[model samples]
Target: MVDVLEAGGWGLLAGSALLLGAVLGYTLRIPHQVVASVMAFGAGVLLSAVSFELALEAYDRSGMLPLVLGTVAGAAAYTAGNVLLARRGARHRKRSGQVRGRSQPSEGQQAGSGLALALGALLDGVPESAVIGLGTAEGGAVSAVTVAAVFISNVPEGLSSSAGMRGAGRGKGYVFGLWGSIAAASMVAAAVGSAVAGALPASAVAAVTAVAAGAILTMVADTMIPEAFEEAHQAVGLIVVAGFLVSFALSRA
Candidate 1:
């Protein structure tokens, strides 16, 4: 089971990397509104998967108390880190406000947007990968399915990164860097998840899973939902429901 899970996990991780590359290499050409809708749907599927599969499994394996504590701890830690990053970004944006308004950037500022994009991808990459890795480590039954689910969830992320680059008027090479950063982070997360899985208690894993789910849920509601709505598309709710059904169906089968 471990061997099967590991193999499936690696495949999923690689698939995620490929999906990201495809987005950078090709999918960015799609319209922004369409992209936003797909992203929202993906987010809904992923958030639901994490809650129903990973967190719930952890709780069943461990206990409710551990799950609750771990979720809180995970949320608190991520929240703190996010807050810090936001503050730093705000400060930097303030200092660079004059430059942003300009038509062109100085040499030092030229790569700033790409750099920021890479940094954001780096922050998100590890955790996303870890979640996938954990899903696989839990067993063969969920391994391949988890990977596919995450791959779909990540489509929007890759799109968002690419869109940011395009909007910033950055080159294709710079956009590709964002995907590369995410792939690299996924690799790191897979390594970490595999290594730690053997030593961690079920409770610890459950807690982390809960925390991850919460963050992902927040992202879906705050970012993806808003983006999906801005496109004047009324089909978003249906798409979201469809995405959830797809994720659930895949997991069950």
Candidate 2:
């Protein structure tokens, strides 16, 4: 119970960034380049965490088979969900409604996009938060690197998505409500992850961890990187590398 509470707290702490970003996006007029740069950095951080913390840890725990199978399964699952959501007008859920060469979504497209965007955010966030609980179940301190990575990444997610929502004509109430619900859900996800991982065997835990890594990696490649490079161009690579190095150093430390 105590561990679960701790996991919830950490998950909320991480997830809270989404609300903060939403507030910023709704209130302020941030530049696309800035948003792109931050998104790239967050993507890099998540990539590093997936590589060093999740996939490697899973490999160390139960060897190669579980890791490979779990990762493939996770990637496939996320891809399928993404496809379904895309068809519902969430294909550009991560955009700020202002793609460089693309026109904004029409009223008909925006009509159903709010729900799809919210669901898409949930899909991206749950697995990441679950891994926090999984870390806690390992009998020591929770992984700070994981928490930090998720927090950093979530800020841009909320910022960009909320900005897009606003562009799509969503009201402030809707924007805040959407992010608030997701934040609360993240807390529940972390607690549930802790509880479930606590009951699972080592091999099972390894598989689950690998699954999250795979999904996150796919998200980065499909959603984050393209958005990051959309505006920032060459410099986004440097920022990504810097973010990756920072996360890698934290993991090593």
Top candidate on lDDT is 2
What ranges in model 2 sit over 4 Å off?
93-99, 108-114
Q: What is the lDDT of residue 122 in candidate 1?
A: 57
Predictions in order: lDDT: 0.58, 0.83
Give the per-residue Cα lDDT of candidate 1 at 224.
Answer: 62
Which pairs clash inside model 1? 70-207
Q: Model 1, which residues run further than 4 Å from truth?
A: 1-28, 77-118, 138-142
Give per-residue CA lDDT, model 2, range 1-253, as digits (tens).
8998998888888889888888988788898889889989998999999999999999999999999998998899889988897888876554445566687677546545656656767887788788898788675578978998999888887886777677677899989988998998889888899888857887888898888888889989988888789789989889999889989999999
The whole-model C-alpha lDDT of candidate 1 against the native structure comes to 0.58
How much is 53 displaced in model 2, in angstroms? 0.2
Give residue 176's lDDT in candidate 2 (0 to 100): 96
